[model samples]
Structure formats: C-alpha cells, structure tokens
Target: MQPLTKLLHFGYQQALSSLFPVIIFLTLAGTKAIQVPGLPRYDLILLVCVMAQIIMVKTGLETKDELKVITLFHIFGLVLELYKVHMGSWAYPDFAYSKIAGVPLYSGFMYASVASYMVQAWRRLDLMIVRWPHAYWTIPLGALIYINFFSHHFVYDIRWVLTGALFVIFLRTMVYFTVDHERFKMPLTLSFFLIGFFIWIAENISTLLDGYRYPNQGDTWELVHIGKISSWFLLVVVSFIIVAQLKRVKGEGFANQPVPHAKDRNM
Candidate 1:
C-alpha cells in the first residue's frame, strides 16, 4: 500500500478500536448537557455504558475473553477511584443512587475503556511483542507501579524510581503491528507513552464534561496538569503488562513470534 493509504487505514482501525471509549466520552458530554428530569447524570452514564457493553457483546464487537479482561480493569479502576476519592485526590461531586462511598459506579468504565481499546487494537492490528521481558520482571514492575499510586500519598513517592525501572525493563521490547498489507514496528515503551498521552488528552475532555473533578477544578475548570502524563504513562504500563500476561497465559507465547520481513505484504 502507498504510505498515505496505509496511514489512513491505520487511523481507521484505531478509531474503530476506540469505539467503546468514544461512546463513554460522548455519554459524559451528552448527559452533562441534556439532563433528565429525574435521572442523575452519573446514573444515566452508568446506564448508557452498560447498554453499550451489552451491545458490543451481542453484536460480536467484543469477545468473551476480552470482556473478562475489561471487567478486571473495571475492578482495578474502581478500587483506585475509591481510594483516591477518599484521599481527596479527586471526587465525584454529583449525587447518584448508584454511588458507593461518593464515587459513581460508572467511574470504573473509564479504566475499562482503556482495556477495551487495548484488546480491540490487539486483534484489529494483529499486535505482537518482540523481545518481551519475563513475567518476573514485568509482573513486579506492574505491581509496584500500581502500589505507588496509593502509597505515594502516605509514604515516600517512588513514582520516579518505578518509572526509571520501567525504562530499563522494557528497553528491548518492541511492538509489531500491521497496517493495511504492510507491517510496522515501534518501541514498546514509546507505544505506552503515546497511549498515555492520548488518555491524558481524553482525561482533559472528560473533566470538562464533569466526568469527575480534581480538587483544582472545584472552583473552575482548567487543563489537567501536564505532569499527569507521567501517572497515565505508568498506568498504561500496568495495563499493558496485565494484558500481555493474560495473552501469554492464553497460549500466545511471548517473544516467540518471528519478525516479519519487508517482502511480506499480507496481514
């Protein structure tokens, strides 16, 4: 394929893979703008997200295994949300019957959307990792990255330390994906950063729609701190590691796929 056509095809696939997340963002904006007489915005968002998930499954857009992975992320995200909200890092200011401890149940979908994107992109792009590190290296790193999110508030902040460790661990890793009939490769760490950056952008959009509010936004809405890219970057690392491990356990052997040659034109 020509370079331009290939790029466009890649973009199309990416957008398709992000369909679920796109729906969530639209729901947030839509609910905020057009409130129901009796329904809370958060509750409405929860309803829409649940309906969207059901549709995705019934329509075969999401596989059963993918649903399982997405559910895991939902749990992880909700736990973090509960802790962060309690710690006053951020809050769900709106009232809803579906809320638990001040967080709307819909909040978990935010994290689930990230996993949804990963699994969809993996299948759509035929993603494979080259030179992936062993589980021992990746699992512990992922655990610490997640732990540091909560622990940093009470104890010493070890985010920078974990970030440095991530670089070293994934230095040799490369993500290979196909666009159109051509194959391309990029550093795995770079992919994590790119995904994180885009999520940061989405975070800004979500906050603007009152999806959730950071303490700074209580009075007025402003751009989320650029430094949040680091947190999102680390979160993306944890998400990627979990997805990779799940894929590995399902018998997609990590670091086993041979790199495709330039002459190969089929996906």
Candidate 2:
C-alpha cells in the first residue's frame, strides 16, 4: 500500500481505539455507584484521541527505534505516576476510578499515545531543519507552546513531577548516548539549550496564567526543573544531529552509487 494510504488507515484505527475509553466511561457514568464529580468528561478523552491520531497519521508512525524509546519512557512514566498517586504526591480532584493495576487504563493509554505522537512528529519533521535556514527555532518554539499550555497542570498535580523527572532523565541519557556514539551528531547544541531555557520560561508563564503561586511548593523545581530543561535541550539537539548525520550518510551513499555499464544497464 502507498504510504499515504497506510497513514490514513492507521489514523482511523487509532481514532477508533481512542474512543473505546469514552464508551466505557459513558456506560459507567450512567450508574449511580460510580461517583465522578467535576471530572473532565470522557468527551475530552475522545477529543484528545482524535486529535492525537490525526497528528500521528499526518506525521507518520514513529521509527522502530523511536518507538522502543517511547515505549520504555511511557512504562517508566506510568510506574512513577502510579507510585506518586499511591504516596499522595498528587490526587485527582474529580473522579475516583482505578483500573487495572490500580492505575486508570484510559488515562495511561491517552498519555502514552500523546507521547508517541510527539516522538512521531519530531521524527517526521527531522529533515525540515536542513531544508530551511533557522528552522531549528521551531524546536524551542514548539516546546514553549506546549509548556505554556500544558504544564500548569503539573503544578496542580505535583505527582507528575516524579514521572516527568524520570522522563527527563531517560531522554537525557538516551541523547547522551546518541551523541557520544556519534550516531546522529548535531552541530548546534546551543540551539537545543536555548529551547530548553525557553521551555522553563514557558512553564513559569503557564503557572502564572493559571493563578498559581508557587514558592518552591512540593519541591518540584528542586527535583526536575533543571533536569527537565537539560533533557529537553539534549533531546532536541541529538535529534537534529541524528537527522543531519542521516542526511549526510544518504548523500554519500547516493554519490557512491556504482555507474551502470551500458551493456548491463540495457540488460
């Protein structure tokens, strides 16, 4: 099948899967036994899933290596998030629903899928930097956008900090290894550092916009602030470097292609 066709198919399949949780939620919501107040309705989950699926399909599925990395990160995040909930590091103000293994399956799946889409988008856009001058700015800009909109909840639910920290560490270590091994060497680590710095700024802005006053509350900064910035920078830089290296390799390979003999070519 054509790549575009495959993308469409994958997207529809994912979109359907995303709605599964909503269906389950609706069934349970009808029951008086399940009390879920002020819970962002399952409709939100459906919307998230639909949007994420569209993004993923548009971007293309993540490469196998990227998928592996994402899976591990998701697993690690899930574990930490579960631990935080258990330890009272954070509490869901709305619904009280625990699924398999004492974690909400729908929430876990949604988060993981979103993370996967992020990785996929990054990979698909990997070559853009080469095509456009100063395209690297998008890395930081996108991070800033996401942090501004999405990070306030982190402050409200500090348990995410533990999971977020773990994710940062995992990403950092992965990027470090990629850089050290010269797998995909980026020439502009400085750009990534800037992006990370901007992410921190965005997060701070998000907090203020949310009317949150945090004076080192829950020690979130103490644990993950610096590390998160560092990791974001490293990940972006390494991703760029890898793309750069891959392009170079591809160019070299094409250049080294053997000339066809006239007789052989005709044959």
Candidate 3:
C-alpha cells in the first residue's frame, strides 16, 4: 500500500516535468482554428518552450546538473533530427522561420522533455537500480543503438539484434524507486518497454497536434503505427544509458543526503 502511494506521487512529479510541453503543444494547437498572430505556430511554440526551459531552471525546478542532461538531449536530438529528416523519416508539416533542413527547432525539445522527466523523476522518486551492468557494456551498446538510427537507411537494420542484446545485458537488473519511507522494484528491461510504449503514445498525440508528419499520414491525422513501439523501445534504452551516466545511486553512501528507511523494494 505504501509503495503504491509513493509510486503515484513519483509519477505525478514525472508528469509535471515531462508532460508540460505536450500540454502546451496541444493547447496551442487549437489556436490554428482562430489566429490573430503574424508569427507561425511553430515559432510561437518554440519561443514559449525556450522560455519554459529557462523558467524551470530559474524557479529551481531543475538542478544545474539536470539541466545539463536535458541540454545534452537537445543537442543529440537535433543531430538525430538532421539525419532523420534528411533520410525522409517523419517531418514537420508547418511553416516556421525557425526551420532548417525541414526540421523545426521545437522538434528537439520533444526529446529534451523526456530527459527532463528522467532527471526530475530520479531526484523526486529517489531512484536506483540493482545489478546494473558495468558502463563498459552499456556505453558501447548505447553507441551502437544510436548509430543504428542513422545507419539503418544505408545499411541493413540491426535493431533486432540490439533488442536481444538488451535482454541479455539487463536480464538480472532491477530498477528501484523509493516512495517516501518505502522502496519498490521492477525489472529494468520492463521499465524500458513501458516508457517506450508511453512515448509512442505521446508521439501519436504530438502528430495530431501538428508536431510532425510521417510518411503515410499525408495531411490527415492517423494513429501512429503500433510497430513504432519497437523503435521507441530501443530509443528509450539510449536515453536511459545517457541518463545513467549520472550514476544517481540513491543510498549506500551514494547520495548527498541520507534517505531514511528508503532501501531496495524487494523487502
């Protein structure tokens, strides 16, 4: 009972940090029905997102270290964006002065939003993982997964092999999160799938909000393919590997502050 309650609170914190951008995008998407502004919708949203990021830091909602993680995602996401857009993957369907290579600047923020949730949830929920693989293995696998995203177009896709590798590497790993004085545990690989599934759902919503257009969607709204789950699953793993670089172990003399009675959830 206690663990469930804490998990809910942790989720609430995560939703606040991550979903704010989606909420804003959805709300402003309605403005297309009636507009009085000379600025394009994409530019306006980009401006608001930039301000929102600054405000989060100024208000102390995000720590400097966390901001660094989020910024890293932005840069990495932009690089992926340039490659994906060039390769005729999903695309932005609107006009924006902020456009480059047919990708709007705001597109990168979509990935940063995920990073914000990861860092915020790590702090808010006091997260840790057990039996985490050594960096030697995780880092190389992450690099390969990231590269496959670009190379799949020219070379044959190896995501199937990578998916199997995740299972092998994380087979014994469990993620732990503290909800108040208690802890709960779940398999790390499962969490990867869950996060990926949710991100895929958000992708559908984003496209409906005019975030981007996929090859088959044509100018009309359509549900994003369920098959994309596999892609997002691997992508989420990449995100996790980057975030794990922080080494945010919560207890056993790792964190700066003591987390009282907050041990691994298996108990």
Winning model by lDDT:
1
Which pairs, if any, clash in model 1? Answer: none
> What TM-score does model 2 achieve against the real structure?
0.34
TM-score of 1: 0.96
The alpha-carbon deviation from the true structure for residue 23 of candidate 3, after best TM-score superposition, in angstroms, is: 4.5
Q: Give candidate 3 misplaced runs (Cα > 4 Å).
A: 1-8, 27-36, 248-267
Instruction: Please give the RMSD of candidate 2 to the true structure.
Output: 14.7
Provide the RMSD of all predictions against the true structure, rounded to 1 decimal: 2.1, 14.7, 3.3
Per-residue lDDT over 73-101 for candidate 1, one digit per residue giving the tens place of the 0 to 100 score: 99999999999999999999989999999
TM-score of each: 0.96, 0.34, 0.89
* Models ranked on TM-score: 1, 3, 2
lDDT of each: 0.91, 0.39, 0.79
* lDDT score of residue 195 within candidate 2: 48
* Candidate 3: clashing pairs of residues: none
- The list of candidate 1 runs beyond 4 A from truth reads 261-267
